[model samples]
Target: MITHIQGRLVEKNPTDVVIDCNGVGYLLNISLHTFSQIPDEESLKLFAYLIVREDSHTLYGFSSVAEREIFKLLISVNGIGASTARTMLSSITPQQVKEAIAHEDVALIQSIKGIGAKTAARVILDLKDKVLKVYDLDENEVSVNKNNTNKDEALSALEVLGFSKKQSERVLDKLLSEQPDANVETLIKDALKKL
Candidate 1:
């Protein structure tokens, strides 16, 4: 039930951070996006979801409300867990997640670690209508129409997996860059080689 924590950052790692709040130190699991934005020398206030199980308790923190909401929705799917949801979120922006569901792009979901084709299809089938209901498609939204936005999404997914953006862009550009016509599978294979 802990909604948030505000305190000095006592420690940090790839997946978690320790915050000193009123003399108590709280450990919170966070996404890389949150980690990249947090300043190492300053205190931080993070929105958190406290999860308790038979053997342990964990706190997951998010940098934005949209990300947290998306996480909640993701975990509500029948077979998805918090770790899967976190990995999905880490691999794509919240907006991209919403869009994938909206577009029913099972291949994009399957590109992430731990999601098989069947599970990815289930996710698309289960959440498609629901996600479209809440997503606000703006007129100026940068349409991810790189011939195959799904492959572009895979590149974005690699970036979320900790590859540098420059590297990802370069790879994607190389694979899809030169073509009167290039298929998604070919681009994906080429991109993976770059990785």
Candidate 2:
């Protein structure tokens, strides 16, 4: 288990980086989020997780321990491999991943490029409690008002106004998450600007 690596950054790419630690240059797979956080010059440190299989040994690195923990949790779910976990992390920030699992927001999880509805639901079902516990988020933080119709109404209005359902839903979800008590009109207006 390579917990972390601290060394001079020899190479930097969107999906990977090479770090020169002592005399060895270690190549680490990284998500876009981590890639964005890494600087192009001098010394750097990344929290790392190594995966060993029958054929290959791979090392994935994250900009923060929190992201690494989320990656580990994501891969622990059945049917979610390291690559899928990386894709998930790459598709969204670690915090968003936590929020999706904690809130059981299947649609938000499914919106990721490779994840489907079933996988999204499975992720929520398998990890929601763990996410809550790991993040120290209580039920109150995870629970959304079941009677909240503002999001639904805003989505319907956006659809009627010719916005795509999926896009509208994503935008509306973001708006509602930012402003939980926003009215339909406010959501619609904010969503329109984002859409």
Candidate 3:
């Protein structure tokens, strides 16, 4: 297995990169997330995952080990292939993917291009526990940071009070952006005023 490659970045594109390691040039497939994370410098090092098939050997590269682990986890699903996994990674940040799975947000998962409702549900069902375990994610901490636990709690309370989820989310997002340190009571009160 090619764990990683450290060399000069000979070429760079959105979908792929070529690294010159000594005398050999290695081509690596990459996602947009990795492409954006790569630094514009002569020397670069990328964590790699090599896929070996009967007729082909492909190398996928990631800017971070976390992204690579997420990719591996995505491909472990029954219907998800390497390309699909790459597309998912390209479509969203690794943290978003993890949160969506942990929260069982089927609509969020299905919103990604090329993913259907069935596939999205399967992804959540198959990987929810694994994601929770691998990422050590607390269910309560899935969607909000400690500083914004109030925001999450308020959102749930609003939902239970029959507020539309989309409207509540927008209201919460705006409020959180403006006042990141707002407490639960303040968030809920502000959200109620907006709604």
Candidate number achieving the greatest lDDT relative to the actual structure: 3
Per-residue lDDT over 50-137 for candidate 2, one digit per residue giving the tens place of the 0 to 100 score:
9999999999999999999999999999999998998999999999999878877665687788897679879988998898887899
Using Cα atoms with residue i matched to residue i, what is each candidate's TM-score against the true structure?
0.69, 0.79, 0.74
| RMSD list, candidates in order | 7.1, 5.2, 6.3
Task: Order candidates by lDDT, high to low.
Answer: 3, 2, 1
Candidate 3: deviation at residue 8, Å? Answer: 0.6
Model 3 residue 99 CA deviation in Å? 0.9
**lDDT winner between candidates 1 and 2:** 2
Return the clash pairs for model 2, or none: none
Better of 1 and 2 by TM-score: 2
Q: Using TM-score, give the best candidate's number.
A: 2
Q: What is the lDDT of residue 83 in candidate 3?
A: 96
Candidate 1 structure lDDT: 0.77
The global Cα lDDT (0 to 1) of model 2 is 0.86
lDDT tens readout by residue for model 3, 51-131: 999999999999999999999999999999999999999999988898888877665677699998689989988998899
TM-score of the candidate numbered 3?
A: 0.74
Candidate 2 regions off by >4 Å?
A: 145-163, 167-195
Counting clashing residue pairs in each candidate, in order, gives 0, 0, 0
Better of 2 and 3 by TM-score: 2
